[model samples]
Target: MPIDLSLLDDDQRIAATAPRGPVCILAGAGTGKTRTITYRIAHLIDQGAVSPNKVLAVTFTQRAAGEMRDRLRAMGAVGVQACTFHAAAMRQLRYFWPQVAGDLPWRLLDNKFPLVARAARAAGLSTGKDMVRDLLGEIEWAKSSVIGADEYPQRVAEQRRTPPADADKVAAAYRLYEESKSSPDGMLLDFDDLLLHIAGALENAPAVAEEFRAQYHSFVVDEYQDVTPLQQRVLEGWLGQRDDLTVVGDANQTIYSFTGATPDYLLNFSRTYEHATVVKLQRDYRSTPQITELANTVIGKAVGRAAGTRLHLEGMRPAGPAPTYHSYDDEPTEAREVAAAIRGLIADGVPAREIAVLYRINAQSAALESALADAGIVYQVRGGEGFFHRPEIKEAIAALVRAARRDDLPEDPVAVARAAFAPLGLTRNVPEGAQARERWQTLSALVDLISDIVAGKEAASLVDVLRSLRQRAEAKQAPAVDGVTLASLHAAKGLEWDAVFLVGLVENTLPISYAVKAGTEEIEEERRLFYVGVTRAREHLHLSWALARQEGGRKSRSRSRFLDGIAPDLEVESSPQRLKRARTCRVCGTPLETPADKALARHQSCEPDYNEDAYLALKAWRLETAREAQRPAFMVFSDASLMAITEAMPATPAELLDVPGVGPMKVEAFGPGVLETLAPFRSG
Candidate 1:
């Protein structure tokens, strides 16, 4: 369906329909930046201002590019090239490889770490994998910043940047790396080379560059604030003096500076393109008023010109409960409490899939993962291997691909899938462990997806479907499963959840000890990270910190300064002692075991919290439904299940099923009455 321009807000309409020359959108967190970019592409196509094939949209990641393509395709503007900077450059380089750098027979080195390690060894460096990785990172930073071998030391000294331990060894390794790449025997280029080579070609080879400029006459750059010097060089090369470009970014979210990305490109876009149309998008639709306020508060305290001006978010959603702040005894206790909170929410009817637990670093996930497992609440880690990459799942995928190649199998892909996996013993010889069970669930999901795709298509063949499936499998794509998400703050960018727990908000954790020592700029980046985590919540936001480490022998820590920046009015603060016993009944002085207990414990005639009334109503309905069905009340609805229902207050049967324990069986049995009990609260 064609997008109706009238549906957009005033700012969005201006962003989407701006005169098509140089444009810059200062989009804040959750301001529908993606929507604006997609709409701008659609608007241009709809207005016949640019052909679909003539436009190019560049994103930071392949996943983001895929999302952009899906959005543009949905808006009926197909054929626009949406891809990463590296991908676009690689395509152009490959097409012009025969013309520019002849017969070198170069191949892109996807993993540069091994090469760096090799060069380090050649340089006689006695370093561990971690140290080598750091050196490789410095190398990447140097390359992206356009720093060459001769200028490496001068650049580091000029910027007051601390060189890696074994600085001399690292420099030697860098020299070796450059030599190896320039040698005839090692005709390999790193990811940075993809942009550098293409930009070099454009700068030196005008004919080849002009051909591309003419081919992609218009452009859109997403996340422009993270563009490095090399990326900007390529963008400039492609733009060549044309003003048909749109850049969308948030300067406050410039968190990738370690990799040489600077906010200068976005901050100076107006100065560069003298007549650039700048639009500020402040309407945050992804977070509650409380969350938006907290984010604004964090960013407001940021120092330096890069902080830009803090844009106060005009929240699009209604007022939600005040954001919760919790202080825990230790990391384990924190993880356990977070897990319990997640469980309570799910039982109250919030879908497990709608909740997320975010942390400052990857190490924090281990304790949380263990706690969630002990609680029997399923969860998927964002950057971990995940269920799709499990050994059993990988084996099943390989078997299916082998089966797909057989000429004797049925032409329909679904039939081929059945024939392939049934004999693989995925269902018959189920594993006994939790990880194995998760893998089994992953396999079942893949089979269902294939069946659904082939069900209505008469012409679908095994080969074509297998090809698509294989591509997705290779991409490490995991099908959606019912589970809470655990992700690092960096990984949680561009994603939001209904309930978000920002865990490990201690002094050294959020700003990190390293950032504290690095000076002002690094501390500012840490605040930006906190700002990012704060904005990734829609309705509920819970911020937590551990007083001590879970591992023995650590001193007690203070709360992060970033947390101190948040206004007290915007959060409901509690210490470990308070959160543990805070729910005791006011009149009876009894510690309520559950939301249901608290509801029933309240003085009958006295005024109570609205949630208590809703919980009482849900419990009554669940008991009656269980009695009528001749089932145990627990089977009809577990306390956790009932709690989730009460809290979520789902209005429809489908929404009711989103609560973790309300699977198809429960939904079929008790959904109508559940909806009835929730209808009044849902309206409120």
Candidate 2:
């Protein structure tokens, strides 16, 4: 059936009118931006003005690419080249090599860590596995950013003067790595090199560039804000002076700067093309009005970042539940409360698969996961290996090493790891024993040793060595049952769930302490990450934080600053349910009859100064929580619960449960005590 696009408003109609040149859609959240852009592609094909192969669509993630392709296919498009900047580059490089770069034979390092570790050992880096792994990340980040040996000092930004492996040595190893790739039987082309080679293909050989230009004369990019410098450069090289670019993105959503992406590409697209069609979408299709209003309030504070990004939820259902802010007294309590919320949401109709519990660091999810289990909410982590232990890694590593040798390792190891280990377990080694521990420890040491070697230099027999390691690891593999996914926010990219619970919304995590604004480019990239997290939600979205943890530990944290970036109309907050600051009458120990409080407003003139204990209680709770435990409480239960109870005066345990947030568990726990403490019913 044809889509009732007539229902689409004017801006959408403009977006649908197959753009002739550069079309920039500065769409806000829920504005049907993706739908409009997808329809535009379908329409172009429908009009027979563009062949499927002639149109190239670029997205930031494989999932996004898949989604675009699926949408186009549904609308009758076939054979469109829809893929990530990296994927597209690789696809083109696969065939254009002989024509452009003289048939250079370079093997790709699909999983560079192991190979790098082997190389590190060959280069002689004596370190623990954890340290080696960290080092590999640094080296990979350097490579990804195109920071060469000569630019090491200027680019690394780390404090070490003499690197663990000296600059000379590291550079020497990188040269070896390059040589390994350039060699006939060598293997190792990192994703960074994909862009490099494509750039070379376009810049070095005019024929290759001309062929691509002739074949793909028009382009469409989704989530354009997340495009990297290399990607942008490649697109420019391919498109040359032609303008047939339709770019859609929201600048206010810029949150992925940590990965070297930028929203400026989308923000300044209009300026980049003089004859561009620019459109702004304010009709959000995701969140409810209550949610939108809170989201709007949060982002409204953003002072002049993006000109046209507006998150309007006026068109969605009036509201669902106002985003509740739950400030806990402690960490465990917070986790427990969050679990309960997940349970309640599930009971209220959210499927187990619909909910996601996200946090800043990988560590935070442990407690939340435990709490969710305790609550019996069937959950699967979005990231992290739930089962597969060292043995599992070795098997995958062995297979991967073998595949790389055969040029058969798929594009993503993470994907392969996921598929292979769906049946593995973490306790594959054995029950506790000194010998068992030693063998595991030795495997750990080897993994560490290999990582150190890989992060340093190139090595030989990498395939054979990994195969042996795999055999050793396989001897102790275990199979796992079902569980929620556990992942870092970075790993959670290009994914969505029915309900997303952003656990560590604290200041340092979502914006991430390491996320820095080195320049205008970096700052814009950071904003794009915020957009990524927000747009990932297909339905329910929960942002949580703790006021404190276990008594005397790290202080509980605040909500993610990204939450502050949302447009107020999005209503990202259910704050009355999360936070409360109520004045009380000293004479009667009753809440103040303030103008905002309907029931108490009549007695406003006679209200007395509230007891200071309430505020003290809040402060005391925040100070006494275990940072971890406190985090969950603040995530689920709000100060409003206590205040609402204190003011409403539920005289009995049953009546107590009648309060919106009160449940049977609370009645069995605090009901008797709270009911006994309500002095007298002093009517307002």
Question: Using TM-score as the measure, which candidate wins?
Answer: 1
Cα lDDT tens digits, model 1, 513-607, are: 76787799999999999888889899989988876664331335778998775624222234433243445654466566676556565545445
lDDT of each: 0.77, 0.59
Q: Give the TM-score of candidate 2.
A: 0.63
Quote the lDDT for 641 in model 1.
Answer: 70
| Top candidate by lDDT | 1
What is the per-residue lDDT of model 2 for residues 158-228, given as tens digits with 9 covering 90 to 100? 62322445665565555545555555554457888888778877987888888889889779988887777
Model 1: weakest 10-residue lDDT segment is 569-578
- Give residue 410's error in model 2 in angstroms: 48
User: What's the lDDT for candidate 2?
Assistant: 0.59
